[model samples]
Target: MARAFQLAGLLRLRQIEKDHAASDLAAANAFRRDAGERQARAIAALHAVPVEATDASTLFAMAAARASSRSMLADLAALADQADAEVAEAQTAFGEAKARAVGLEKLEARHNASVLAGELSAEQAAIDEIATGAWVREREGNEA
Candidate 1:
């Protein structure tokens, strides 16, 4: 009988961990994209604000709007940076998980190969014994 892989359970756990890490990385990437889009919209709105003001009050309001846009853009930029960091962390975790799984996978492959070889050898030995017996029986008949 072929021996089962000893680390199959551990390998399955490692694969699960890798999958979770990949999911986290995807979410981080999505957050970064969202932050970038928000920053772009804020910049566009800032530019759309009318520069020409007929009265001092209008000019002050425009200035205030521009300031608010800049502040929002800055916050978004910071969020994007945080997202980038998270993505990097997630990528590292995924790589580590994959590496851990790979070792077990290779071991399982080797174990399977060894079992197959043993089975093939046993079959060949049986065939050789049957051929030897037939040859001996024929020789006895010829001598008789």
Candidate 2:
């Protein structure tokens, strides 16, 4: 009975680990997508700043602003690359966790089957003991 409790506790722990892994995968995917969106928005804003042609000084200022925007977009692209790496790591962890969950399920099934077989054997032995005493006929008709 104590062993059974221990086994059950271990199973619960594995299940919790499996759940955490799944969550980590989701978070990583979300972060990757968010980073891409941020980079796209940065580009759009840079493009939206239109250049005016009335004055040479204003035109040069606009050009400088565009250059700055390009630099920022490049930075965002680097961030997206970092996010991709995180997503890949999370995917690996998710695969490992999924495998573990499946393996644990199989192990639990095997343990249950073994326990049932043991109980069945004990019951069968008890039945055999009872039948033998009654069916033997007490020394073929009692003499002592």
Candidate 3:
């Protein structure tokens, strides 16, 4: 029988940690995409605001609209920046997690290979012993 891997539990924990990090990275990327889309919409709205006005009231309303659009754009830009930072941090975390998991995975592979080799060697030894016994029985029968 093949021996079980000694670090199987630790390997499982590393894999779980890596999976969680991947989820966090995905969420961070989604938030960044959302922030970018909002920023783009704000920019488009700011550009769409009318500059031309026929009267004082219309001019005042236009100014207010442009001001509001600009303020929204600024806020959205800040949000986008924050989202970018979050994505960067998440990517770093994911990379570290992956590295840890990969190391353990490699170790597990080596352990499995060693166990297989041992089993194969034992099987071959048993076959050799059986072959030797058969040869001895045939020779003793011929001598009789």
Best candidate, lDDT: 3
lDDT tens per residue, model 3, 1-144: 678898999999999999999999999999999999988887776778667899999988988887887788889889999999999999999999999999999999999999999999999999999999999999999999
Clashing pairs in 1: none
Which residue runs does candidate 2 get wrong by more than 4 Å?
Answer: 1-6, 116-144
Per-residue error (Å), model 1, residue 9: 0.7
RMSD of each: 1.5, 4.3, 1.3
Q: What lDDT would each prediction earn against the true structure?
A: 0.88, 0.82, 0.92
Evaluate residue 8 in candidate 2 and report its C-alpha lDDT on the 0 to 100 scale: 69
Give the per-residue Cα lDDT of candidate 2 at 144: 39
Candidate 3 backbone collisions, by pair:
none
Cα deviation of 75, candidate 1, in Å: 0.2
Specify the highest-TM-score model's number. 3
Across residues 1-144, which tens digit of lDDT does each residue of candidate 1 receive? 788888899989988988888898888889888888888887887778678999999988988987887788888889889988988998898899889988888998998999999999999999999999999999999999
**How good is model 3 by TM-score?**
0.93
Least accurate 10 contiguous residues by lDDT in model 2: 1-10
What TM-scores do the predictions have? 0.91, 0.71, 0.93
